[model samples]
Target: MAAGGSRPEPFVVSSVEKVHRVMSWLKEIFGSQSLPPFEKNSETFDLLYTLAEYSEERERDASVLIEDMKERAAKYDAEAEYLQSILTETFDLSPSVLSEEGSAHLKTLVDTAMILDTKDTSLASLFSAISDRSLELLAAETKNKELELNLLEVRNKLTATLALENQLRMDLKKAEKDLEVEEAKAHFRLQNLQFLKHKSEDISIRIKSAEEKLIAIGLQESLMHEPLMKLSQKLAEVQEETVQVKKKLECYFNLPTSLPLARVKIEEAKRELNALEEKVSMRIEEMTDDFLELERL
Candidate 1:
């Protein structure tokens, strides 16, 4: 970028003023025809001409440096934007948002390029001014690197959160599968108990018939007593099994409640990720607009 704008030559103006003042002084000292010889004063006029040329050359050099600076600033800005676009594409961000973020980093360089030594129109001052702009560019470049590192950090964080989200989802699915298996087991146990209860009722009827037969035929009572006692004990065991099955089924039925909590955590994570993305986008947009204005300067 240009260090400064073109300015009126100070030497040229002062030289003219000096010549006018000398003539006025000479006219006061001597009448027009009796003025000092031209040969005696030629050297002074030569010096004035030299000063004018020197001033012109200095101004031209400053102008050229300023133009060169402007070109360099523009090229750097373009390259910064191009690199930002590539990074955005690789990272899966909106182009406008990333582009603006990149431009924000170049704002300082752009502003520095627009600096001009219009007021102090001297080579030394112009050079100093250009040097200051170079310093500003260096600082801006440093800040740009910092910004890139920060962006990378954010991307890494996002990636980690996404991975966590996937893991959570897989856990939820596994939980669901486990609950289903428990439910199926509970259902089978309940069915088995009901079938056993039906069989026990039939055994009770057979034991009653065996008792009537034994009384009519005068058979020993011990045989009837053993079978009846065994049938009663089996019936008691089936009832106990039914109770245990109900308890297990109830426990499995409550498993679904935990699922909702797990799902809620995943949803919370998703919301956080979305909010982060929105914040980044909004900040980039604002910075981009501000930087663009600075570039125009």
Candidate 2:
């Protein structure tokens, strides 16, 4: 202070100022309601320093008091260590932040971020993609459902068709059975007709042989053919009786007897020389019974 041409004692802390500063510090620390305002800065740190310079605790430098405390240790000297604790609580010096270069890039991106026109462009694209995917899924599901329905329909149709085919097969089997019965009956009748034809042929051969015998016995010329005339008359009577029996059979059976009788001849030149005896006649008894049964039928 003397080298700078200033009075050292006047500039130094005075007794009254020190007292005033200490009072101010006390007010800051304990809150003295009776203390008045100070002339200058009324901060607690300023007051404490001013008071310390004049008090017995004075040292050459504040560093000597601070010593190893470094941060606000002096503020907690007479108190419950509250102010120093608050100072330490407010700061965090842990090295947990990202690198400086990464922070700068992130800051630039944040500062230049785009916040316009995206409502129209980005939302439209997202909505279109979503709609397309939804439509595709819907179509695929519909197709699968339709295929299932078609499969069910096809199965139903197949079942119906099989049922119909089975019914037709049953009908065909019944018809075939009926047809077989009819064929058997028809074949039996055909064999009967052929047998009748063979019997007629045998009867004709026998009659021819008898007529030859009668001719050898002079039955044709002697007595002016009396035996031949009688034989012819008898043949005529037999033919008349056969016609009547045929008519009875035809009338009763509602059939045309002409079909069976058309092959038989009634003319003298054709049928006059009959030979079979009445007892040996094959057609007599059976033909008579057949005519009677036909009339009843």
Candidate 3:
């Protein structure tokens, strides 16, 4: 507000090094041998504070004021020294004269000592304040370092966890792909088995139908063979009848005989037809058995 137009206040950061430096300087400042005051330019460096003990005005050159105070203290010291020298050197004086007439010089000596004592007390109080600030600063620094280390550890753990999570994601994807492949194979195998079963059923049905048809055809052939055998027997009997008629015609008209072996030849033809009929019956039975087997299949 005074010079920088209301800039935000700077944070007060104290350290042991700064505290030690201030203490040493304070010791020098308050020492009896040295000066009580070494103030700085207010325009260059801000004042330590605006306490009533220091001054009423806030904007003033502290260095000049402190120099003036030091000069006054030096003058008081010189007067006190000079008074002691006078007391030691000059002895021809009455007690009333020394007490009354030298009262002003005695007062100067007492005031100087009081100022020195006050400065020593002030320096000691300031040292206590510096020590407190130093310890607080050290504690703050340690806490900050601990917090930083904790954050680093947490960050590292998070990074490792992320890596592990990514690996798990990849593994999950692989498992999904494997599951898909197995599912496809299962589907294919199921369809193939279904097709084979259907094909087997179709083939079995066709074989049964073919066997049934073949058996029916064989049975029909057996029936036709019996009729064919009867026809052959009839033909042989007709031939014998024809020979007898021819012999009768020949004997009635006085012709020669020509029907000697007609009956024997008819009997031989009948035996051959019976043998063919038995063979046909056997073939029909074989076909019927084959048809039953096809039905079982």
Candidate 4:
């Protein structure tokens, strides 16, 4: 203590003192409410104390502002009462004294003032200008609405027309496709008809050539069909009968004595020969009738 005779600071704040000061500030701000627990360190105490000081300063400023506002409000109220008394005594202006029309006009003026964003309703010229401007604005709005409706209708019609155009385009495409298919079918049928016509002409030429050849051989063209067929069948049957007769003659020549059995077999053969002769005569008669009919034709 005697080396340099330096003295320690007299009003040094401990962490506990700072914490107490913070608690007192909190009580003043919050009406003595229980404070929440917090860490009791030097840093914590210092921070809390700084915050408490700031809050106390703000509270003081707010209280001063409130007092000034109350004084102004009291002054304004007194002025309003004085003005009301003057209005009643000098102009006789009151709810009972004002006519309904005057009240309505006053309300209109007040509303006009509000719309114009001003408190001055003493300018008659300003109210007239505002009323004219409002009328113009209303007319403009109505015209704009009508134009919008017309535009909407035009758009709807355009949409419908576009849709119809698309449908027609599709139908046209389909029709073109159908026409192409039909044209192809017609072309194919034309080709088939031409081929058939050519084939028929070739067959006719062949038939004509065949008829010419038959005429050169001195045969009637009519003999080439039914009559020729009948003659060929009859010639075949005669050849078969001749072969059977040769076979019977050979059997008769090769017979060993057995005359009685040979006679019985010969009788059966004779009956078969008679039957074949009768059939041949009938065929000849039929051929003669056919030849006569052909001559007549």
Error of 2 at 214 (Å): 3.2
Write the residue-wise lDDT of candidate 2 on 134-244 in tens digits: 798899999999999999999999999999999999999999999999999999999999999999999888877766775676543322234546655765787777566
C-alpha lDDT of residue 192 in model 1: 95
lDDT of 4 by residue, 157-241 (tens): 9999999999999999999999999999999999999999999999988988887786786766546665578786876888589
Error of 3 at 76 (Å): 23
Winner on lDDT between 1 and 3 is 1
In candidate 1, list every pair of residues with a backbone clash: 1-69, 1-70, 2-66, 2-70, 3-66, 3-115, 3-116, 4-116, 4-117
lDDT of each: 0.68, 0.59, 0.62, 0.79
Ranking by TM-score: 1, 4, 3, 2
Encode model 3's per-residue lDDT on 8-117: one tens digit a residue: 78976344434454545455556766644655444212323323214434325676788889997897578656656766678644334677647776566456446444
Better of 3 and 4 by lDDT: 4
- TM-scores for candidates 1 onward, in order: 0.36, 0.28, 0.32, 0.35
- Candidate 4 global lDDT: 0.79
The list of candidate 2 runs beyond 4 A from truth reads 1-137, 221-297
Model 2 residue 185 lDDT? 99
Error of 1 at 254 (Å): 71
lDDT of 3 at 104: 71
lDDT (Cα, tens digit) per residue for candidate 1, span 119-223: 233456567887888899999999999999999999999999999999999999999999999999999999999999999999999978977876677654533
Candidate 3 ranges with C-alpha deviation above 4 Å: 1-128, 219-297
